[model samples]
Target: MDTSRLLRTTGTVLAAAGLLLSGCTTSGSAQRASASAGGATGSGAAHAAPAVPEEPSAALRPYYAQKLRWRECGVPGFECATMKAPLDYAHPSSGQDVELAVARKKATGPGKRLGSLVVNPGGPGGSGIGYLQAYAGIGYPAQVRARYDMVSIDPRGVARSSPVECLTGPRMDAYTQVDQTPDDAAEQAKLVEAFKEFAAGCQERSRRVLPHVSTVEAARDLDLLRGVLGDEKLTYVGASYGTLLGATYADLFPGRAGRLVLDGAMDPTRSAIDLNRDQTAGFETAFRSFARDCAKQAECPLGRGNTDQVAQRLRDFFRTLDAKPVPTGEPARPLGEALATTGVIAALYDESAWPQLREAITQAMDGDGAGLLSLADSYYEREPDGSYANLMYANAAVNCLDQPPAFTGPAAVTAAVPSFEKASPVFGAGFAWASLNCAYWPAKATGTAHRLEAKGAPPIVVVGTTRDPATPYKWAQGLAGQLDSGVLLTYDGDGHTAYGRGSDCIDTAINRYLLEGTTPAAGKKC
Candidate 1:
């Protein structure tokens, strides 16, 4: 597979898991308007409102004034709301409103309510509200849930709100198949063409929405939500890319910070290129862990040997697929490097998925690519009916807007390939180059890399998994170090984030903090 396709696949998977839950809804229009007008007076009373710079445009003023009415939704204890935010923060008066989907499950315990606890599953584009309703809202420790009203909001350009859609199902299907690791000049040209096509499609389909769907803008919009939620201080738990969003919020509104927990944290100081390279190396580390475990298993494909050799073998398989893809169950859809890499990347997120990855690879080696393809399909969030979610589009838009592209073109990618290869030997070159996708983005970035230092914020917890691949453990260390009042909690294990992925020690530490305003030691390791 070519680099672009790999990026599209990875971006798609991350975005889908990140923001799949929230979306725009038409049913709550009247309620939204009434809530906004009714609650405007008390919205800023929870906390000292940040200075509203100048008069906001009439268009954005209404959204800022809007109050979210927590009405009963599908979940038994949770209430949902639809709020509005400005499309462009710079031109807040533009009158172009983007909807934000929100959900909250009220506390059930007898203790006095501490406040709302907002949570996010990272993807720069992840749906905060969706995660709250699906997992965190109901599954969080009963003790923590008892003291806080669990809350979440779908950021701009994400699902359950006004989503930033770029392509139709058919167009996205075609986009996903484009190769990323081109072998020759012709293949390289094909890769460039694929990027152009994807960019052009997004531009044509989402011209109005693309430019405004940036992380910085999303952070500002979050402040608006914080105000509307009537919280004196913003309490949040963010994972993966959500960490970046949370940190951004702290940077933009330090005074509003409350009990924040950033799990599977991201380092805001790294450049896009550096972040990508580090992530590539992290994946290699995770793959080595998988290889070590697989070699002990009876069904090991690469056999019992050095992990380096297993990695090389996997690379060789990818090279072979680059030349000729194998047949999957679907006749028109052959399993190529992009799909194979995606399958591997999916497993790297959680060690629990390692066994499944081993089985998938063993099946692929046996000429049945169905298992691997299924893993890849799950990562991409591909529906059984040949439809796709809008995750990739939103991910690209948010990532591209958060920082500039790592590389400008194929030449830059070629130069970086060797270094990338050195990082992972298996996924390095491809992932390294995959970081360049934003170079062809249709919109300019609205944010830049900057350190987050929430100096006046209350004690915040930052969790790190020692062997996390998606968001490396070092990122957690860095983010914790950067935050003025950050308390580091380490989970000496494998996985993307640490809160609910079955670590009793880790969960207890976080729950204690959330329920009683107690923080773990600065460097407590589980």
Candidate 2:
């Protein structure tokens, strides 16, 4: 997902680990019924693939040998560090370098330490250090926290790590509500201009960093971090987009993978177009689940009706908002269809937020859109003061650099709309158009879709929440099947990620693996 156009993840609080199909309009039928909350079981057939060379080149030896300078920062008990990595690995000899912000909470051990266990809560744009300090530092199971040092690094071009900057607060505000679901040529033209301006602003403000934030570079940075931490191998727990980062690292440094757990996994072999469509379908699946549950309630916003009826009603509401946006308390902003849709999608990540969504929708239906607007604001990381974080900027920078655009222009999107709508009727058109955001990206993509068969790696667990909205369960299944040593752990449940959010079955398996290096049984369902 293009984090820039698609608002994903809250900054410090790792509340929900799900994907939001942003910058798209709401218009999709149920792609699939709600998936079972059970682990996947099938043939463990590995695809024919070459092994990734584990060793780093001699020219880059200095970077791998560099030591981190750590100092106490943020919450007590967590120490922060900084390291410098080559801005471009292809030109390691170049003088250019990018700073990485890292944080660790040393193991509170009574037993032998299990080395550093790095954690990332997706959003290629999410602040790893922020996640470490706010959640993992204190919220991880006590046993896991006591045995292993919890570590994180804000990848290049993310928060506090030489971030990518695009539009200012006011400009970004206007950009979010651009007629994403264009009804005519003029609206489409305006949408294209918005993408162009966003791309141009990123290039203008963050020219140097934009091109270097690809997942490949970020994964390489992880290997460097592993070396500096004095860990011969990398131990990691990554969710959502973080799974892509973890898989890339495992592919790049197979021998270095030490009990990596990729929750909410993405299929490395899939193209950007397929990924967006699959994700669109996932959201539709999730929304249907939400709609079905909503219909059972007396205060249901879409009213007590079947899934299709509820979905159609919501679509109708979106069209109504598109025609005449509801007044949000904020003077400059109105509850337009795009933002309102984002607000609703944000809640679909975790079932815990369903009640909030119900309330927000009820409020929106009642002529007050403040609740829904607040939800949208949270999705965008827009502060009450109106300032925006570097999340969106960095999201685009990394996503665009990681792969070629899914669609090159409005024409291509128009051509692909039918397939997208087929995958997700309500969300298809908007997401099909949203896929074009990267078409106008300033930097060329440095990576391509490929299978990660980390042939020499230790057991690497790939977790999937069957009903995951951002990364569908099938992605996890696909990734596990592709990796040479991947094991599947399924959490047949509601929400984006399975670990830590609440699942003793899932948590126990992960904890045992992280602490004792015990691989969960293949096809383990929680």
Best by TM-score: 2
How would you encode candidate 1's per-residue C-alpha lDDT over 252-289 as one tens digit per residue?
A: 56777777888877777777787788788777788888
lDDT of 2 at 225: 92
Off by over 4 Å in 1: 1-64
* Model 2, residue 388: C-alpha shift (Å): 1.1
The sequence of per-residue lDDT tens digits that candidate 2 reaches over residues 51-104 is 334666765789888888889995899899899998877667778899899999
Q: What's the TM-score of every candidate structure? A: 0.88, 0.92
For model 2, what is the error of residue 195's alpha carbon versus the real structure, in angstroms, after optimal superposition? 0.2
Question: Could you tell me the lDDT of residue 298 within candidate 2?
Answer: 94
What TM-score does candidate 2 get on C-alpha atoms?
Answer: 0.92
